[model samples]
Target: MNTVFVVGSLNIDQTIRVPSFPRAGETIRGSDATFSPGGKGANQAVAASRAGAAVRLVGRVGQDAHGAAILQVLAESNIDSSHVKLTDSASTGTAVIAVDDQGENQIILSPGANAALSFADVDAGLATLTPNDVLVLQLEIPRDIVRHAARAAKLCGAFVILNAAPSPLEIEGLFDDIDLLVVNEQEIQDLARLANASGDLAELTETLPSVLGPAVLCTAGAQGAVTFLGRRPVHISAPEVSVADTTAAGDTFVGYLAASLAADRELPAAMAIAGRAASIAVTRPGAVESIPWRHELPTLQDHDTQSAALFLSHP
Candidate 1:
């Protein structure tokens, strides 16, 4: 089995259910507040482990209750947390989230110890990686550390998957180090803007492989996802389901995708599994709580063959 090393952030999320999003300088009363283990890296690591991958998470936390809670969640999920370091000077990373009844949410993040993660920390964690392993990364950590990890993983001959979330950052030479780039509609737009590539979805998708890499998966919620492989595009429709909370939906997708790929599944097959996992995630509430286990996933009939055919035909 291929191991997955996640070098990213671990945050304690403070979530509140609100009637609607608050406007500028407007205070709105909310329902009872809840705390959950979150952060893109932690959520994705849990998702990957539950999806049947050997996963290890490398990040930083504070010497506080919130940090302990984050480690507890990882331990319960059976993910390796030995690389998660505790700092005395900083508090654990925190995210204040407000979710409306409709499941839309707004978040404010305080990086805290997550920002304190150094390249040395990442290097020590990555030392366990073999060429067959996969390195999963997100933008929640410092850009320099992300760049270093990506470079080191590439040098080690491990496949690197980068989830460019939140937004695009000006990280030099980062794109060249990525094996697979995953992004949502908004993220793709942000990437296109950063790369100065213009056009509609099709045009942009067709142009991305030449600029970003050989593979770029651009997801459009409800509308489905488009896979760009070396100028070829394959469209995969998302499974229709009622959404309860969208928290960690994207993380679930990325996690399942990495798990499937690490298990030697082809890109198309991996993407189908990921899409299904994400479809199931949004039907539940909370972050890690919303992700589905491998046993819980329904078999997709002919999905692999059909998706592969689409991919090949496009090429």
Candidate 2:
């Protein structure tokens, strides 16, 4: 099996359940605080591993209790953390999250040690990837380092998969190195603005690959995801489920997609599996805690097989 290498951030998520999001300058009381191992990089790495992929995570954390706890969680998830760097200069990255009864969440991030992940770390991480391996990345770390890692992965003949989270104003040369670009609805709008293109989801989905890469996966919560493979857009419907917490839904999708691809599943099958896994994720709480294991997923035997076949046939 091809390995999934994640070059991204590791954060200790401090979450609280609230009646609703606090207004600006308003002090709102909430439920007791809870801590979890999260961050786009760690979440996706854990998700991929849980989805039955061999995942290696590369990033930085402080030499603090939070860092140790994060490492322990990764170990428990069966992710290789050997490349994870521990720094004394800064504390572990953190996200302050507030989730309401409606499962909507508001987050504030403090990069901390995550901002310190250097190109050297990226180089070491990319060294482990071989041709056909999946190299996953996010924007939580330094954009320059992300660019360098993407370029390096491309040079090594690895498949570069970038989840353009917290989308930036100018990606510059990074798009050239990405083989698969994953984005949510808001992220697609941000990218569209950056490219000076139409903000319409369908138009962006159709035209993004021409400017960005060969494929773009645009995820619209509840509405499912649309994958622009060349000029054709393949839509995958997300299963309907009551959402408990949506913190890790996107990460779960990205992770399962990478895992399915690494396992050599076709794009349609991979999307179906990923969508199902993400549907399961939103029904639970926390980041890594919410991601479903491979055994926990429903067997997509007859019905989903036909659906995937039909989608592929049409596209």
RMSD to true structure for each model, in Å: 2.8, 3.0
Pick out the ten consecutive residues of candidate 1 with the lowest summed lDDT: 306-315
The residue ranges of model 2 lying beyond 4 angstroms of the native Cα positions read 301-315
Q: Mind giving the per-residue lDDT tens digits that candidate 2 earns over 1-315?
A: 799999999999999999999888999999999999999999999999999999999999999999999999999999999999999999999999999999989889999999989888878877878897999999999999888988898898988899999788796787889988899989999998888788466667778888776478888887777776555567777677999999989999999999999998988788889988999999999998999999999877534423222333432
The candidate maximizing lDDT is: 2
**TM-score, prediction 2:** 0.94
- Model 1 has an lDDT value of 0.86
lDDT of 1 at 185: 72
Model 1, span 1-315: residue lDDT tens: 789899999999988989899889999999788999999999999999999999999999999999999999999999999999999989999998888888877889999999999988998999979899999999999888888999999998999999998886663476778988898877887888888788765566667768776467876677566775554456666778998888899999999999998999888778888888998998998898899999999988674323323323432
lDDT of 1 at 45: 99
lDDT of 2 at 122: 79
Q: What is the TM-score of each predicted model, taking all chains together?
A: 0.94, 0.94
* Model 2 clashes, total count: 0
The clash numbers for all candidates, in the given order, read: 0, 0
